[model samples]
Target: SQQGEEDPQALSIQEGENATMNCSYKTSINNLQWYRQNSGRGLVHLILIRSNEREKHSGRLRVTLDTSKKSSSLLITASRAADTASYFCATDAYTSGTYKYIFGTGTRLKVLA
Candidate 1:
């Protein structure tokens, strides 16, 4: 399992602040994706970055990947209480001759109002 692990297992910040999370994996991946889950709801795809790309942005979200370091980071700017949720990093990697999508232990973020 090439499952990644998110740093700072939990985070808390005031609304309107910025939040950042980091993920590290053990294997090579073709691409990395970030997902957000609101409470018990399903995961919502936020951003994806291929190994060939260094950084990508969508709205208030920014994602950066460093294949050489087998790591990735997600940043949310001007975060709101509505942004309080669990953030996960998934990786698509070819392992044991099979391509697999693996998710990491998520980071629980709390944006206090």
Candidate 2:
């Protein structure tokens, strides 16, 4: 499958703490992206790291990619209660002359106030 798998399916942390999530995929990809989703809502694109990029950051979010390991990690620094959400990793794969996205199961994060 082209889908990635996220580790530590769930996480709980206090406000101001940091949360980290990891994802691993089975196939080569052009890029990997991280997304956040509130309950009963659609995903919010957070960051994208291309295969040639080792790391990228936006606001308090940090993303890392390791093509050699087919893995990626997302870190949210100084998290807030509002940061509580499900995080997912998606990869862009070209198959059968079409581009398809495979999303990981997701990591549920809970930030306590």
Candidate 3:
């Protein structure tokens, strides 16, 4: 099963703060992707890094991967109330022959206005 389990399940922070979330998976994967879902909106792809990559960054978002430990972390810098939403990590197992993605429970982030 290609599942990434995220801890806490919820988070709250004041504006201009930072948020961090961790994800751990069970099996090997080709690549990992982070997505953000804002309320009723569709999921937006934040970033994707392959297994060979150790870390990647995009704007205020940072992601790190440790294949040895089968874990990863996502960091959001200078968080704003606008950033209030749910973050999820997904794993893609190309070798598993399943094109579907398995998402974590997700972390509901509430950034105080």
CA RMSD, predictions in order: 1.7, 1.2, 1.7
How do all models score by TM-score? 0.93, 0.95, 0.92
Q: Candidate 3 — what's its lDDT?
A: 0.91
Q: Please, what are the lDDT tens digits per residue for candidate 1 over residues 21-113?
A: 999998888899999999879999999999999999999999999999999999999999999999999998685989877999999999999
Candidate 2 lDDT tens digits, 30-83: 999999999959999899999999999999999999999999999999999999
What lDDT is obtained when candidate 2 is compared to the true structure?
0.94
Candidate 1's TM-score: 0.93
Q: Best-fitting candidate, measured by TM-score?
A: 2
> What local lDDT does model 2 show for residue 77?
98
lDDT of model 1 at position 68:
93
Off by over 4 Å in 2: none
**Which of candidates 1 and 3 reaches a greater TM-score?**
1
What's each prediction's clash count?
Answer: 0, 0, 0
Worst 10 residues of 1 by lDDT: 92-101
Score residue 54 of candidate 3 by CA lDDT: 98
Model 1 RMSD vs true structure: 1.7
lDDT tens string, model 3, 5-96? 98668999999999999999988988999999999589999999899999999999999999999999999999998899999999985646
